[model samples]
Target: MSTQTQTETIVLQPTPHTEANTNENESTQDQSPPEVKWMYPKILSAGLSFFVAGVNDGSLGSILPYVIRSYDISTDMVAVLYGTTFFGWLVAALTNSTMTQYLDLGPILCLGAAIQILAHVLRVWLPPFGLFAVTFFLASLGQAYNDTHANTFVASLHGAHRYLGFIHAMYMAGCLVGPFVATGVASANVDSKWYLFYVFPLGVGIANLALVGASFRDRMASALTSSRRRERRERNASGGALKEIKETLSISGVWLLSWMVEYLVNVRDGDVKQMGYVPAGFYGGAFLGRLLLAEPTHRFGERRMIFIYAVLCLGLQLIFWLVPNIITEAVAVSLLGLFMGPFFATGISVGTKIFPPELQSSAIAFVFVFGQIGGSVFPALTGIIATRVGVQVLQPMLVGLIGASGLSWLILPKDAELHRD
Candidate 1:
């Protein structure tokens, strides 16, 4: 049977036997405690997890100079840090679905939270440079798990597009906060006390764990168990993780979006290289764009509007490239960020619509892993190339990436019906 057909059967499967058994099932369900709804608290907690991830991701660039100073390392050496991050996401991509088969959602989330906490604990003490790099791997693994699951859960809810926007906005909010915090802590001591900034996320990580536990406690085990059983039954016909990974990777949308985000984040700041605060404007623009553009993008249609946004981003990149003034470059970069902000969430949203329901989690996880690849590989490549050529190459590189992203969107499979807002 086809994967979609098999999934439909699993979902529509009837209870064995007859009316009495059906009545008994209904009675049992009626007596059971009310199902945990996707209440505000649950949504908020999910958003917080993404927020934590954002802070971790955002702080790196801002504090990188401090790290370079403290470790006496060259800029190119920082590629190792991003390399470790890709490793973490790779591990998550390989293991996420398999882990879900054996563990409940709550436990999985807790595990991710614990991993992040451990990373922060290591960071707070100003460990060796090697250890610091290891911390990113640990943290990225945690983020991969937390973010993939949280995104899947949120995307399944009512008004999912809006909620996805809100959660991603929270992530941007964290990214926005990270720079200020890292810069502040770094400047205050100027003696390598910048590592102390990790203490902030350490506290936030604990709260993230607590909130995930509390909010998901009721349904985590049962829901995950049922999901696994269904997945197992389907696996025989559909193949397993390898098959799903192949399917996800085959999707052109995944690769294109990955390239877009990678270039957008890594290259946009190339013009004003030393000013750490400048990238924050990019993130801030992304934050606002996700918040403000969610509705318009949906109203106009994801595929169409995304292409429009990409064109706008390309225009901004050209201006940033040709413009001589740093102020103009910064403004262009921020506008580029604004245009690019909705791409990630929208891409995932489209994935959910395009992929089979049973494969959504694995598919989304795989897409995200590819994104991590882009995020890590392109930046490292940029760093290596910038050392030889000038950082000025970032502009034309961004233009190429943006153009490719638009073309990719143009060719992605069009849904017969748009997902309701």
Candidate 2:
């Protein structure tokens, strides 16, 4: 039974833009689908999942200090909790390449949301340390599915690079809001501040489930062709999971980008926010970056803007490291955030331009997985060093990482093409 039906299919990532649909008559040269209605609402709905994830992840990180205090845990032990989520992301990336082959958005998203709710509830119970890590991993498992699938779905509907800003910005908006809400709840002297966080996932899950159920009717179908089917059947004998992973890792660019993100978070973040003002500044900058600067940045030039951003980030890091005053440091930190805010989303756009649609998911996931590795590995290393060299010196070391990101971007294969439109 050959499932093969010959038709040329082009898969678009972030968003789909086709030459057939391009209109020369339109004055504005926007590549987006013209005369489309209802699409915006659907995009927003899909982005809401990222929003939920942002809040959940951000709030947890914001109040982690409290969690540590309450549990009387050491920094090393607490770092494990952070590392656990990274491992979850890594596993999800590896698994998703195969998982996307068999699953549809509706069921997988619903299941992910349910798992998140369960993880939140389990966290409130204050289980043992190992149990806590397991629960976090469970939540991350859901997050990975939701995040990757949502991006893929949205990309299928529209030009992914153009609209990815809106999606990522919404996520950043949630990240900004989560801390505010969590802090407010935690301040009320209520034994249940953490409990309030669960309310979001619960309500969101119910709504998302309904939304997905209705929308699945028009969604794209994933059907394997006979050739692909044969490939899969033989995949087991052809080196199996090990082969799959090796093939994925063989993509040099993905590993390079991933390592870049890893360096940024693990190494640079310490310097950026050693005094706690960096997140506030960065998120604010991110809000403006996505909301205000994203289009112009993309329209005029994405690659040039990125280069400029990297240079500015390097300077900001120097200021944050050298300036002794809290006020001055805060100012520099905020400015740094403004420039650095657009890095990931812009990079995503660049990637969408580089990779074909069919390979987009794996490419996106590959970079993210590497970023997570950096996220997990560097932070733990910093913690170990912080004990001996003191946390203050970690700031200068962080500057080095930010510089590394810039250097990596310079070495990118097609830096010249990045500025094309």
Candidate 3:
């Protein structure tokens, strides 16, 4: 049954469940709690986790030149990193709900942090080529767990769009810093030891672990006890999760939004070049965009406002394509980033509002998985296309992606992106 929404903020409510499940699972922590004081700390921890993920993800572009030279790998071999990162997220996306069943949120976050830290540690020593590629797997898994749960957790709070922006902006902030630090470290040594860049994220990853543990101490209790009740809870959780997954996949907006983010980032050679300074501007633009979403979104409802922003993004992307000047290109790219920054988090916000609490964890996980599939497939696809068609193809390719992204935003439900499951 569809849960109708009269206002944009009404997304906090979930789809109606059967009477039996509603009463039994009513305490499922999907609503904003009456007690708001402690939530701030947990939210801060969640933001920090996204920061770590940004650093890890952002460092790769800066360090890739070094990897190619040092490892003597062909361009095709580099695709392995994307594959590993994709699969790592795929694994986390698949197993995250099950882990939630067996472990509390705090421990699960700690597990992700630990894995990311391990990946960075291995990188600092300049592991073998194959081993270095595998590190991305560890990093992506760590990111998916901490950030996805953090997103769902924050979406449950009051004024969710604001908090969602806070965490996602923290991610952009990390992306802004990652390449800056990586470039400096890699260029410093006479030997050009790009591996040293991992050290920065390693320290941050350790701090992320501490913050999650300290902030979420109340929910950190071990949940490994075996019993009939535990077994029943797992079974119920699994069943609800499957239902949510089915419903989430049925929504066109979910898939469209996922493709938007992937296309924007992956098609680097198209209208956008891998110019270091220009990309930094884009990340910085995204930082400001996410941080400042409240006023406009409130003034014009989210559904309508987001569509406007997307149309503006398409226009900016066109300017980037047609203008021959580097300065114009830089300005257009940055502005484009500003408009497109909210794509991923907005989709997650819709999922939280539409799916029931029992269905949410799994459904969100699957949505995340689809959001990521393009990241795995697009980099290699773009590279091969670039090799065959020349970099000029980026102009039209980007135009198509931006146009499609904007259209997809329009296709989302007018009422808080509601979907009847």
Candidate 4:
């Protein structure tokens, strides 16, 4: 969908002339004195934030064994870190919409970067095990803030789907780089300096903060004030943070897309029973698919192509399930990743088109949080079930999930008019 079509679908309540003039005056006064051309900078800043987040996410597994050895902890104890990470995302899910009510884009992004930097700093020094666990919480919290806002902003731009693809591809690229760097750093002096791997993320986090601050500085205060003023002027009863969250949670697309991603992640690793390198093939395919298929997916239609991708992914999963050969499984998994890559960005694009501008950030955040929930919960569920039904069940489970995802997508409202909040 085009930006114009999206804008047209929103029904903004008219403000009284007197109040409008007052708001205009206040908005003008609130804006920064110096104007900045922020388009490219914003894009770069958003991409860098994703890169930092990806590095944080991907490097953890590489460094985990070292952490286990250093702390003299069992493998099961590592679940604490994952729990903390989930808690961080949970916090974001509950607070992000409310935070945006008071904090401007620049301040929020800066705050997230600061939190991430603090996380890395603690890790690089090899803090106590408990402190190290806390670091994951901080990093995840920071990621939640940065990623949700960046996605919302990018989804509003012209050719948004393509840019979304580019930013996500950057994330996958960072993921690819992280394991190598962390493994290399940890292996250098396996006993002592494994913690130094965090230095890289710390440096990148600083750069992320700088870029975001520079890009969004001029509009920071004004954007917040303007949005609030518009909400008040329009007398939008549903504009409150709570209401936005509720509405976002109610959307079908949010749940379906979340399920799709959860199934994708679980199926690729759990079902295929592949070695580490094979999963890398999946990520590599996804990276290329996002870069190569982005434009065509956008041109063809996000809603239409998503179902097609889901079907393709489902077929590949079936092949992987029935086929016994590791080579064929690897090939099928990579192709599945290629098919699934575009779904996420396309889903975000769909949200942008269907949601009101004022509620975009919260809606997108809710969708992402839903995705995170599924990604964490379903895999854990699969693990427990695997203990009983065996890991072989993973393939059929994924097939069912993918089928449901496609059906849900088919029922979702498309290009529907939304009331401005």
Candidate 5:
């Protein structure tokens, strides 16, 4: 934030008009760099936050096989794990607005990183099955906090679409790196010690905490210290929390991402080393998609472009399922990731334009919460259903999701109507 704005806000009385002006100023003030050049550090810290989130999410699919075997558990256990993750997000969703009303970015973000580090600490020791499932709750709670705040901040910037894409692509980059590291660590032994893979993200999460501390050092103690400001805060918390959940769905790569590697390995009978590369490929495609597609998505307009991309994704998913050749399926899945990648960032960009300024931050938080709900719920459902039938169910289920994704975009405003809002 600019010095003048900070100074002004620090001195302002808790009056209604003054509060409104402060909130409005915050929308553009953070983007307008202060003479000391603080924005880059904060932006870099935000990117690192996404990378941490990506590693946590991306590694899950790769390590899943080992988890199932090592625990001697059924896919039902995975469902329970997802259920725990669901509650983590649920808790964050319920409390995030209240937390934001009282705390500033520094405290909330630091708290999130600390919680996630705790989750990883629990996992690295190879804890009991029940405890292991509970770790996801902690992880998701941390992720919801980080994801909502970082996304809202970036989306408020000058070139928001580009920055949004960059941070999200950082997530895909983490997703890309996660599987390679996870597979290597998990497969190194005759008996797979998959829990050891978490040390990497744990270390990274520590750095994220430190980076956030350094970046937001200016605002660390500048929270809402006055009890009189309560009424003003209630308005801020009301709706701004809703927009965040839409953007977080990219984390676990939806239903197909969780199962893609297993599908290649189990269904196609490909070697682990070879087939394990598929999720990485999907993330790589997604990485390029966010980097390459954001501008076109902006220029051609989000609603139409995303709809076209969704249609293309559905076709690619069909190709992935129907083609008998493993190479063909592999290529199809990656392309699907590429097309699907733009959806998360683009959705955030749209929400910022449409939402009132006061509610934007909390709105973004709520969006993350809803996506967390979806990300956990559907995959958990898939895990339960897979136990009944098989992982081959991914093909039809994924195709339906892609189609529904296309239809969902229709509900967003048309390109011409966007700026008018």
Candidate 6:
């Protein structure tokens, strides 16, 4: 039995009252809390972790320019530092399923927060760029675990669609705040300003740590009982982690989705953030896009919305490429952010609803891991193109990649399949 949406009633099996059944059996079953009632807060609380993750990642990217200038590093080295975050995600994607088997959701979330806090402290104390990059990777690795686990946990909870949207939107909210807060701090002090970026996350991380402790007991009790049954079966299977991974990779739709995100990032590739006007424009648009359109877009139907967004995304990339003046580029990026803002959230909402609960976390991770792959590969490709062809060609290449992702939308399952029980 399943309750896919929050508005829906709890779905549970009724126990039979046979000749052998006794009064004690009825009392125990009667005492159990309704599934829907218990699941609501669990999903909501888990969503906050995604919020913290967005704040952590968004703030770092926003402050990257300060780090580069402060350390007197080459541009390529700076890119490598960003690249390490992707490397961390890649490593997490590879190992997460195995790790989840032994650990409870609450412990995992708390540990992730702790890791991120330590990484922040390390960045503040350590002088060298190498350590900075290493710490950033470590932080991302922690985030990766929390992100996947949170996605998994919420997918099992009540009202998957609304919960998924809120969770992802919270991440967007964090993204919206991170740059503004970091930039504010940085602008206040010209010298030694990079250290200022750590302030917001350090505070949020502390709050999140406390929340984890409050919810840990109830959430873990539910998670262990549900996940353990699956774990036992997996253990009984003769094939090990490598086999599980290979099996996961073999799914056609999963690979196709990964390709979709990889291409999307290719279209979005470059240092759009570090430049004064461009990052501001992109995220500013993203902030407005999410606020104004996320709910309506979801209401219209996630699949069709993605298709429309993809087309608009392609156009935005084209505008950035061919249009003259930094102002025009900024406008184009804003539009890009506006259209692309809901893409990941929409993908996750639709993907979770379509896949069975057992497969939900891995599937969400699969899609996000592709986004990470895109984050890593596309920027490097753009670097090569900019060096060889000219920076002017970057937008046109983005247009092309956007078109590729849009084309893949043709093969995605229809809206009916998306909402099916």
Full-model lDDT for every candidate = 0.68, 0.55, 0.64, 0.63, 0.74, 0.55
lDDT of 1 by residue, 1-421 (tens): 2433322221111111110111333444323322235457778988999999888888776677667768987656777787888788767766664565566666777788889999999999879999999998999899877876677666655567888889988888888787778767877753658899999999999999999999877545533447545554464244343233322231222112212222333554332124556667777898999899988998888888888998998898788667766678768868977888888877766765665655555455556556666776666666576566744555566677788777777766575344553
Clashing pairs in 2: 11-357, 14-155, 14-160, 15-158, 15-159, 15-160, 16-158, 16-159
Per-residue C-alpha lDDT of model 2 across residues 34-127, encoded as one tens digit per residue: 4333466556666777777767655654455446556776555656765677777666655653544444445666666667767776765556
User: Per-residue lDDT for 1-421 in model 4, tens only?
Assistant: 3322222222211211221212334444432222224667888888999889878876654565467668987534655676677788777765664565566667777888889999999988878999998988898888877876777667656556678898988776666677667767876652557789899989999999998889877546624566664563343334343232322221122112212222333444432111423445556677787788888777766556778888888898789778866679768867976877776766666666565655554455556665654555454455456455544656667788777766656655565432111
Q: Give the top-scoring candidate (TM-score).
A: 5
Q: Please give the clash total of every predicted structure, in order.
A: 0, 8, 2, 0, 16, 2
- Measured with C-alpha atoms, the lDDT of residue 118 in candidate 1 is 95
Structure candidate 1, residue pairs in collision: none
lDDT of 5 at 89: 77
The regions of model 4 sitting more than 4 angstroms off are 1-36, 61-78, 125-128, 186-194, 220-275, 319-327, 380-397, 414-421
Clashing pairs in 3: 270-394, 271-394
Candidate 3 per-residue lDDT, tens place, 1-421, comes to 1211111101111222311112444474664333433678988998999899878766666666567668986545666787887788767755654565567667887888999999999999788998998998988888777776676667666566678788988987887788688867876776878898898999999999999999878667566445523542443444433433323231122112212222333444322123434556677787888788644664465556667877887788788666756668778877877877776666666666666565554455456555655555556455456455643555666666666656665655566534211
Tally clashing residue pairs in candidate 2: 8
TM-score-sorted candidate list, best first = 5, 1, 3, 6, 2, 4
Q: Which candidate leads the pack in lDDT?
A: 5
**TM-score: which is higher, 2 or 4?**
2
The better candidate by lDDT, 4 or 6, is 4
Model 6 misplaced stretches (Cα beyond 4 Å)? 1-41, 221-278, 380-394
lDDT of 4 at 227: 60
